[model samples]
Target: MYFTSALVSRSLIKNAGIIFSKQPVPKNLYATRLFGTSLQKQAEAFIPKQRIKSLLPTNNSFRQAVTRFCSKAAEPAKGQKAVGWWLVGCSGMVFVAVVLGGVTRLTESGLSMSHWKLLGEKPPTTKEDWIREFEYYKQFPEFKLKNAEMTLEEFKFIFWMEYGHRMWGRCIGAFYAIPAAYFWSRGYFNKSMKIKVGIFGTLIGLQGLMGWYMVKSGLEDRFQDPNDVPRVSQYRLAAHLSFALGLYILFLMSAFDHLMPTKQHAIEITQKALKLRKYAHISKGMIFLTAISGAFVAGLDAGLVYNSFPMFADRWIPSDLWAISPAIKNVTENPTTVQFNHRILGTSTLALISGMWMLSRKCKLPPRAHTAATAVVIMGWMQVVLGISTLLTYVPTHLAASHQSGSLILLSMAVWLTHELKYLKKLPK
Candidate 1:
């Protein structure tokens, strides 16, 4: 009976040991073991030394493992950063395009080409080629009526200006398309981003078409007066400018999304932030509207008439604002009305932005948001100054171009402010 009891006791002890050995150790315990703690020493008696050594990696190996894990985790963030910067570059190209377009218009170079090609034509390089281009220009109404005294050298200046603008636009397409395809193939963009990229591409194509359409309006023999200058349709000009602004906004906003994604903790927005957001939304809309109005101002060359600010022709409102028939026609068609309306809109936008900035100070905004708000106010005032200077100087090409660029800059700031204040979830009442 004593021998049988000894065999059963030994078997029970063996089974208990196997069960304890099969249990997994926590990572903290492994770390503790590595440090040679008392608890680890105590554990060594039960866990086989050979098994412990096999399970615990060397210090260098452990560090390498951790580094690999972290790098894997950061891969997505790195991809997003690349996409963000690419978008920033594209937006910059669009900015240059806008400035170049403004210069082309200011120089009266838009009508110099007189011919349109989708893929573009080779520029005149030789003297004979230059004459051929010049002869072609002479056939257009712009040359016959407006630039009849233009020399070949002068024609070259305008031709090169228009040519540069068109070529730059084509360059934008190539710059966007090649990078976009590579990124898309790399699976960097998700489904929604893919759709936005598609839309952006389509808009670029449409903008090119719209540009040609606007140019065509000028080429047609639709002058009502023999004294009328050959210029593109004001309506077409406004449309073209609007499309460019729209694309700029989209590109900039998308870039912000990639660069400044909202944190999960930012979902619970504060009441003051919510209120400020409303103000920001209004300011953004006003900025856009003011920009659109400036396009009309450019379209009508209205800045030339409004040389005086805070008053037009020494009066608060010009007398012939509604000189054109139907009154509504005067809003866009009449230079006096367009300039007056742009002045009102511009002043109102500035006032609205200034108020929003004041409110932002009390809102306890995020750091980035606070900075964006400050930028918006500063840019708002700067834009106003530029506009006034452009007018006071009688719309010199450089000043006028700067004024146009300033509008987009102001709008960009407004966009930045709004984006910083963007909320992922609904605001609590």
Candidate 2:
């Protein structure tokens, strides 16, 4: 029912070879009574008639059974293409969800609602509901320190940002599970592929739990003073971002497998080109690590701590890179160290991306891979520029958010490049 094209093609070729070969016939057929005739008629029937007899199988019954088996094996199924495309669409939606998550972080709306109410009901819409929700937030440290005087309108601003992000996550869950169930029920997915999707789905569910876990860190009195601003642990933030990216990469790879499976184009490309694609996945892994470091930078508000660029406060490494009294305090608790590490990771990402682009220039890569690499290079440069501007401008909210969004774009491009390289060429121009 789910035969691969290669399998069908092989079966057809084998059957065709068998059909083209001549089969032996019994000599006794010529001795039948109908064959008795004049000399010319006897000779005419003897030669070509014997050849026709040689072509037929000794037993037509056995030949018929073999033919039926070969025919069934070679016939194509109608649903294969539909199943592949459905997986691609589902992955693309998950990628969109990742982007929205970045927006939520950029706007500082990740921890807006201090409570994690799973299945509490959809967000409140009525006037009375809004007031009750706003009242709950007022009890948090963020409201006291940063938004002490924030108006109802301002509260709505942050509320919508977080709500939209949460809603998108819910939509992704339904989109993935419902279609997956439908496809699985139809027996469209292969055994190995189904296992992969299951693991991916599990990670997605875990990511939701991680989100709530991350938020819970900042909801309580982590700070001694009531006036202090509470923030999620940088470690948890890094874990959240890293897991999201992991899901993105997995979905991206699965989508690539559907769009242009390696088995489909396995022989088209040269060995060198194929090897380059393998290396690209390694590049993606490095970028993912850099992105997590970036989260650690953001969670500690590292971007705001040091305004200078190319150097931290006109120094290569600040005097007190680990100045915090406790040893572990500097990595996540200290803003300066976090910003320093972020700058280092940002620089490293730019360098590695540049290296990838340069390597691509000398190789014979597909259009999708080429385009993705170029886009990553371009966006990496833009993000660097934006990062410098953000630092020099003291991390203005708008510019900082744009820089954050730019990172998402760059990450998407990197993920796309790895996928395309693994799959093969895009459509011919």
Point out where model 1 deviates above 4 Å. 1-78, 264-269, 424-429
User: Per-residue CA lDDT of candidate 1, range 235-350, in tens?
Assistant: 88888888888999999999999988865334456676778889898998988888888888887888889698778868897889889899899999899899988888989989
Prediction RMSDs, each to the true structure: 9.4, 10.5
lDDT of 2: 0.70
Predicted candidate 2 versus true structure: per-residue lDDT over 250-282, tens digit per residue:
776666666655433433566556666766676
Clashing pairs in 2: none
Query: CA shift at 63, candidate 1, in angstroms?
Result: 12
Q: What lDDT score is found at residue 310 in candidate 2?
A: 78
TM-scores of the models, in the given order?
0.82, 0.75
